[model samples]
Target: MLPRLIDEHWRRIGFTQRPKLAAIKHLCREVDLLHPQVDDNGRRPDNVEYPWTGASGSAEVPAHWKFPLMSRLHDPSGKLLLKAAVGLTRNPAMFIR
Candidate 1:
């Protein structure tokens, strides 16, 4: 799953820059082993499902679509280093200590 996603990312961006690849690799490892499995059918009653606003309505909407990938991964505890590497936050120091 991770490899395929990374490959798709590389193809999308036209290059696999070292830092980006490294971050992707790290995230692949850091993500809980069951995280990908949850994509199958983990929708909760409390979970909100916003309408997919793509230009083409024919595009397949994922069953578990909620937030963008980056936003879903954003947290002080789970993948702060990856967030820092991606410049999602300017100050990781607060999360670190």
Candidate 2:
């Protein structure tokens, strides 16, 4: 699932100096594995339907349609990190001392 998405995203996007494959590989590794499954009950999506139209629409309009891989994984606790890899706060009081 992750590999295929990275491949597609790679084609759509380009890097300036570096090869896209390397960038995609690095990006994939950087993504948070916060929700291995989207559901709280640990359910993975079985059937994935991609967008029929290109560029015209991005968001899902109705229950019948969905954006299968639109979002990138962010920290579930909302503890986004700084450029130095020092953790910054998105949500406070989510940690134990």
Best by TM-score: 1
> Could you tell me which residue pairs clash in candidate 1?
none
Global lDDT for candidate 2? 0.33
lDDT of 2 by residue, 1-97 (tens): 3334434433455634322444344334434322333332433222233222324444433235443333322332112122112211333222212
TM-score of 2: 0.19
Candidate 1, 10-84: lDDT as tens digits: 466666442344555555553443343433344321113333334454433446554344453664322534543
The alpha-carbon deviation from the true structure for residue 31 of candidate 1, after best TM-score superposition, in angstroms, is: 1.8
lDDT of 1 at 94: 29
| Ten contiguous residues minimizing lDDT sum, candidate 2 | 76-85
